[model samples]
Target: MNTSRILRTTNVVLLLMGYQRHWFEKTSHRFRLSLPSVVYIFVLGVVYTACFSQHFDKSSSTLKVLKDISPFLFGLIRVQLALGAKAFAYAIYSSVKSVGAINSLLKALPSRNSQFTQDEASAYLLLTSTFGILFCFAAYIAYEMKFELPPLPDAMLGMALLLPHFILAGSVRLYTVLSWLSRGQLKELKKNAEEELRANLTKDPGNIASAIFTVSTEGLENLKTKLEILEANFCIFAQSLKHSMLFLFAMHANCLLGGFYTLTYYWNTWYVLFEDRKRRIFYAANASIYAFIASDYICLMVVLFMMENERRNFIEAIDLLLAQRKLFSKKLRPIAKDLRGVLKKKCFKFGGPFQPNIIYVSLMVCLQIIIVTLIVTVHYLEDEISLLKEEFSSTDDN
Candidate 1:
C-alpha cells in the first residue's frame, strides 16, 4: 500500500515536471507532452517496484542478488546523481539564456529569415529535458532500492550497476532527436566559418561577421518553442555530458552483470570440481570480461577526451575573434577555458568535493572488476574446457 502511494506520487511528479519542461520548450502539441518517455520508464519502474514489493521476503534469492550488488551500484549512481543535479542547474541557465539569445538575435537580424516553419528545435529541447528528468527519477529509485533509503540491498548492486545503462539507453533516444536539430545549424556554422576564414586569409576581410538566426515570423507559441530551443543549447550541452557518463557506467554494468551471473550459475560446481575451485578459473575469465566491460568505460573516457580536444580546437580556431570577445555573440568561451584548464591539469588532487570522498567506492569498483572476470569464466570457459576434455577422452578410448 505504501509502495503504491509512493509510485502514484512519483507518477504525478513526473507528469508535473514533464509539463513544466514542455512549457519551457513551448511545445505546440501541448497535449502530447503528457506522454514523454520518462513516463514510460517511470511506469515500468513503478510496476517493477510494486510487483517486487508485495512478495518482498518470499522472493529472497532474487532479492538477495539485488542486495549483493547494491553498494557498487549506489556508488556509481551517486556520481550520476551529482551529474544530474549539475545538469538541472545548467538547464535553468540555458532556458533563460536561450530566451535572451533568441530575442537579441531576432532584434538584431534584419536579413535572416525569422520565420521557421518546423519546430524541430522544440522537439530537441523537449526530448533532452525530459530525458534528464526521467534519468533522475530512475536514479532515485536505484539509490533507494539499493541503499539505505528503504533498506533493500543484496542483488540491488546488479540493478545499481545496470540502472545507469538502462537510463543511458533512454538518453540515446533523445540524442537522436538532438542530432537532427543540430544538423542544419552545424552545417551552416561550418560553412560560414570556413568561408569567412578563407576570405580573411586572402584579403584580411576586416572583421567579417556571420548571420543571426531568429523566429519572429512564427506565432507566439512557435516563438515560445524557439525560446526554449535557444535556452536548450546549454541543456543540450549538459545532457550530452550526462549521457556520456551514463554510457560508461552502463558498459561497466554490462560486463559486471555478465561475469557475476556466470559465477552464480557455476558456484556450486567449483566447490566439488577443482582444487583452486572456480576461483582461479573465474579470475582468468574476469580479465577478459573486464576488458569487454571496461571497453565502454574506455570509450566513455575517450569521448570526454575528444570533446575536450574539440573545445581546445575551437579556442585555437577563433584566433581572429579573440580580440573582439566583447563584441562576439556568445560568452561561453570563458567557461570553455576553465573546463580546458581543468582537463590540462595532470595533477589530480586526492581530497576534494569535485572528486569522490568514499574509500569504499574504490573498493567496490575493484571488486566489480574481479567479480566480472569470474562471471565471464563461468559463462564461457568451463564449457569449452569440458568439450576439450571430452575430445581427449574420446581419443584415449580409440
Candidate 2:
C-alpha cells in the first residue's frame, strides 16, 4: 500500500509538472498570466465550494430542488441553455448544408476534382477572427479569478484527453480538399466504359453477338448511365468524416471539463455547508461559478476559430476540384434531399463499421483544450469580476 501510494504521488507530481510546461510553453507566451495568481484563485474556489455545499445542506428547500433534478437531466438542460436556439440552428444548418454541398460537389465532379473545388482564395478562412476577438472578454474574467481554485488538475485532465479531436478535424478538412482526385477518377472511368461499348458495338460483325452487343450498348453505354455511377455514396460520407469527428471531440471535451469543474465545486460547497460555513461559502461558490462560466465562453471562442479554419480549408478544396471538374459530361443534377434538425440516425448504423482513426484523437485534443481553458479562466478571473463590473458600469454611465 505504501509503495502504491508513493507511485501515485510521484505520478501526480510528474503530470502536474508536464501540465505546467504546456501552460507556459505551448500557450502563446504573449498571453501568459501569472502562476501565483492562478494558485490563489484555486484556493479560494475550494474554500467557497466547501461553504456553498454546507449552506445548501442546511437549506432543506434548496436541497429538495436540487434532488428533483438528476445529474443527467441537469446536464442536458445546461447544455441546451448554454447553446441556445441560434447555436442549435446554426449546427443544423452547417451539418446539412456542408453534407449536401459536398455530396453535390462529389456527384458532379469526376475523380481528381478535389483540386478545382478547393476555395484556396477564400478570405473567410479567418471568418471568425473578428468575432473571436470579441469573445476575448472572457479572458478578462479569467485573469481576475486566478486565485480562487484548487490545483486545476481536472481541467488539465480534460484538455489532455480532448486535444486529439481538433487535430483529427483539421486532418479531415485537409482530406476533403482531395475530392478533386475522386471527381477526376470518376470521369475517367465513365469515358473508358463508353469507349469500350462503342468499340464492341462496331467490331462484332456476327449477327448474334452484334445484336447482343448493340442491345446492351444502347442503354448502358450512354453518358447519363455512366455518369450516374459518380453520385455521392454512403462510402463518400463515411470517407469525408475527418472534420465532423473532430467537432464531436470538441463537444466531448467541453462536456467533460464542465462536468469535472461543476462536480468538484459542488463537492467543496457541500463540505463547507456540512462544516457550517454558510455565507462565506456561498460567496466563494458564486465566484468560482462566475469564473467557470467565463472560462467556458473563452474555450468556445477557440473552438469557433478551429471550426472556421476547417470551413475555409474545405471551401478552398472544393473550389480547386471545381476548377478541373467534369462530373456529368452528360449532366444530371440530383435534387436536394429532405433534411432534419436532429441527429436521429442510430450511432452505429450511421457511422458505419469503419474502424476509428486519428480523427478520434484529434477531437479529444480539442476537448482537452476547451476544458483546460475554462478551468484556468474561471480559476483566474473570480477576483477581478467585482472591479470589472464597476468599470463596465462606469463605462456605461459615461
Task: Quantify all predictions' global Cα lDDT against the true fold.
Answer: 0.39, 0.36
Model 2 lDDT-worst window of ten: 333-342
For model 2, what is the C-alpha lDDT against the true structure? 0.36
The candidate that wins on lDDT is 1
> Once superposed on the true structure, which residue ranges of model 1 sit more than 4 Å away at CA?
1-32, 36-43, 59-165, 172-188, 202-232, 235-306, 312-398
The digit string of per-residue lDDT tens for model 2 on 1-398 reads 12122222322332232211112222221112346534743553354344333322444444355446334334543453333222323332333334443434334433221232323222122222222432453344344455355334433322332222222222233222323223333434434543433333333234533344334434333443434433334235444553454444444445555555545555544444444444444444445434433333333333334433432343343333334323211111110001011111222112444423235434545667666667645753663586699999999999
Superposed Cα RMSD, model 2? 19.1
Q: Highest TM-score: give the candidate number.
A: 1
Q: What TM-scores do the predictions have? A: 0.35, 0.25
User: Residue 164 error for model 2, in Å?
Assistant: 2.6
Over 4 Å off, model 2 = 1-142, 145-158, 171-234, 240-398
Candidate 1 per-residue lDDT, tens place, 1-398, comes to 12122222323443333211222122221111233544554564564344334334556564455446444433434454344334333433333333333223222111223343343334333334434554554465455345435335434533443343434333333222322333333233334443443323312223323311211222322322432342344233334335343444545555566456545544644345445533554445445544444433333333333333443454355454545554433333343233334323321111222221124234546776677666566645776687799999999999
